[model samples]
Target: MMYAAGLAGVAVTMLLILIRVLLGPTVYDRILGINLFGTKTVLVIALLAFLGGRTDYLDLALTYALINFIGTVAVLKFMQYGDLGWAGDVEDDSDV
Candidate 1:
């Protein structure tokens, strides 16, 4: 019962963070909310696995963490400059 309550609380917190992400005043704030949501998700997954005696599920959490980090970096770079180029190394592929 306690474990369920904890996971439910984490889910509620995640929902609040989602709202913040939607109504953020700035790109950075939204990114921060997104990062927080990802972190909470990882923690909840780990907690559930531990409660269930399923340690192997941790590998899934690790994969999600790596993907989340990559996505956050990409989003930060795009928000800073509105482009996905190689950090100010834009290339023109037209020969006129």
Candidate 2:
């Protein structure tokens, strides 16, 4: 019973995040919402695994987490530089 309630709460939170993603005024806001949604998805998968007594879901959740992090970083990098490759023309001061 408690597990069900917790899952329901997480579901509700995801729904709220979805709404924010749709209605967010800025690109950054939407991106942040997406990142949050991904985190919640991992939690949901973990919770489901625990409730079902299956350990395989944990593997899936970990894979998803890695993918989510890479995807988020890629999106943010693309948003900032308009491409995935680092701009060679830009000088790095840290190397100096």
Candidate 3:
């Protein structure tokens, strides 16, 4: 029962994020929507693990959350620099 409720919540969040993503005024707004969706997914995963009686799944959820954070950071950096290889004011030894 609890698990069902969690799934419902996740569905609701996804719908809301989709709406925001569609109506977003800027790229940043859409990126925010995507970030929110990722967070909601992590919660849903944790809830599913609890429902399935698998504590180990919670660890997996955490791992995914970390990955999501790293991915988001990378995306934001790329967006700001217009390239993933940006190294602001820093020169690599190989460049010398």
Candidate 4:
């Protein structure tokens, strides 16, 4: 019962985040919402796996986590630099 409740809560939160992704005023807000939604999806998958007593779901969840991380980083990088090339040397102003 607890797992079910937790899953439900995560689902609701993901749905709310989806709404934010749709209604967000800025690209950054949408990107943040997508990142949050991906995190919640990982939680939901893990909860469902526990509730179902299936260990295989964990593998899927792990794969999803990796993909989500890569996707978020790629999107954020593209948003920041308009490209994915790592050849450009970024000067850190913090060092100044």
Provide the global lDDT of candidate 4 against the true structure. Answer: 0.90
Q: In model 4, which residue pairs have backbone atoms overlapping below 3 Å?
A: none
Output the number of the TM-score-best candidate: 4
- Ten residues in a row with the worst lDDT in model 3? 87-96
| Each candidate's clash count | 0, 0, 0, 0
lDDT of 4 at 2: 96
TM-score for each model: 0.75, 0.86, 0.80, 0.88
For candidate 3, the TM-score is: 0.80
C-alpha lDDT of all candidate models, in order: 0.86, 0.88, 0.86, 0.90
Q: Candidate 3 lDDT, tens digit per residue, 1-96?
A: 978897898989899998998999898998899888888888888988988889789987898788888778888988878888877655545663
- Candidate 4 lDDT, tens digit per residue, 31-87? 999999988989999999999999699988898888988888888889878999864
Worst 10 residues of 2 by lDDT: 87-96
Best by lDDT: 4
lDDT of 2 at 70: 87
Task: Write candidate 2's Cα lDDT for 1-96 as tens digits.
Answer: 676788899999999999999999898889999999999999899889988989799998898888998888988889878899886455656764
Task: Write down the worst ten-residue block by lDDT for model 1.
Answer: 86-95
